[model samples]
Target: MVEQVSVFLENTSGRLAELTRVLGNAGINMHALMVADTSEFGVVRIICDSPSKAKAVLDEAGFGASIANVLAVEVPDRPGGLADLLETLGDEGMNVEYAYCFVRPQGSSAVDVFRVDDERASSVLQAAGFRVLGASELYSS
Candidate 1:
């Protein structure tokens, strides 16, 4: 499992930039980011080198931030890699709540970050021949 930092912000101009600036100023390097928004608010989920520090900095900067555990799995950088993974999860009765992907700096594979409903997702996926990444693996390319 990897730590993900989630920040809540108003859907206003400059809010996103301000959040990024805060993370940048704190020297937190973001590996992956996904944003979900409504008309009035937005939630920014970030995979970073220092999730705890990132949340702390965001809080000090007046942004509501929290940490969550998410599974980071290695997937082949091929057309059907994602589909296969999803299929395997479905076969095992695992439901994915949300997910995002990012390619590493020096790899032929992409990492898929998932917020799944089951706690056994990591073990199940590993049994199904997937590499579940921990914080060190996720942060260091």
Candidate 2:
């Protein structure tokens, strides 16, 4: 499971810059990130090389943070690609709490990291036509 650091920030200007600067100054590398915002606050979820370090830095900076385990599944970069996977999970009675997708380059495939309610990720992956890639696998290739 790939661990993600979720940071809560005020929905104002310079908040993201400050957070990134703090992490950058602390020598933390953010590999992937997703930001969802409400009217008052924004949730920035990140996958970094050192999740604990990132959380510590955020805490020192007075930002509310949390760490969660997510499943990084590689999916085909095409229409209905995600639908196929979702159908499989639905068939097996696995609910997807939330998910985010990111594409590599023009020549490579895309990857979607899903945050599931339970640790039924293995079963979901086996049932779906997707490959559950580990963090090492994500870094290696």
RMSD of each: 1.4, 2.4
Q: Which candidate comes out best when scored by TM-score?
A: 1
Task: Please write out the lDDT profile of model 1 over residues 30-78, one tens digit for every residue.
Answer: 9899998999999999999878988999999899999999999999999
Could you give me the TM-score of model 2 versus the true structure?
0.86
Which residue pairs collide, candidate 1?
A: none
Global CA lDDT computed for model 1: 0.91
Ten-residue region with minimum lDDT total, candidate 2 = 132-141
Candidate 2, residue 5: the lDDT equals 90
- Each candidate's number of clashing pairs is 0, 0
**Candidate 1, which segments miss by more than 4 Å at Cα?**
none
- Candidate 2 Cα misplacement greater than 4 A, ranges: 105-107, 139-141
Query: lDDT tens string, model 2, 8-110?
Result: 8889999999999998999887767899899999999887777888898899889888988888887888898888888877777778888898775653667
The C-alpha lDDT values of all candidates are 0.91, 0.81
